[model samples]
Target: MSKIVARGAGVVSGMIGGAIAGAVFKQVWKLVAGTDEAPQATSDEYGWGEVLVAAAVQGAIFGVVKAALDRSTSRSVHRAIGG
Candidate 1:
């Protein structure tokens, strides 16, 4: 029962973290690229450097957010379960 609840909480945390990461990525992209729209890797308008950097930043933000949320959820679950 506790494990099930933890799993559900982890899912919820991931969803929320993803949404937050999207917003953060957009803001970062605008600042880094000086554009509101992010560039696609295959797009000709941007060079490979720009596209790769954007991808790396976005991925890093998402990974960080997910990790933080997962950690917090795990701690909460541990406390709730008195473990």
Candidate 2:
């Protein structure tokens, strides 16, 4: 049960992080392009296809980061335990 909860929390954290990173990227791109206007969001502009692609990419990145953090924590705990 604890493992499941931890996994869920990790996923939620990843999603939030991804969204924030995406927003930052969008803003930076706009700034670099010298566009003062906000981009328009049309129903067909960003459909499920774009969303899924972005999610997949972000998910992979998040997964790798989470795995690395978990491994580092495990190693630290092991060292503290003199193992």
Model number with the top lDDT: 1
The C-alpha RMSD of each candidate to the native structure, in angstroms, is 1.1, 6.3
Tens-place lDDT per residue, model 1, 1-83, is: 99899999999999999999999999988887789988799899989988888889999999999999999999999998966
TM-score of each: 0.91, 0.47
Q: How far out, in Å, is residue 68 in model 2?
A: 0.3
lDDT per residue, candidate 2, 13-44, as tens digits? 66666666566555654565455433333445
Error of 1 at 44 (Å): 2.7
**Lowest summed-lDDT stretch of 10 residues in model 2?**
35-44
- Stretches > 4 Å off in candidate 1: none
C-alpha lDDT of candidate 1 relative to the true structure: 0.92
Q: Name model 2 segments beyond 4 Å from true.
A: 1-44
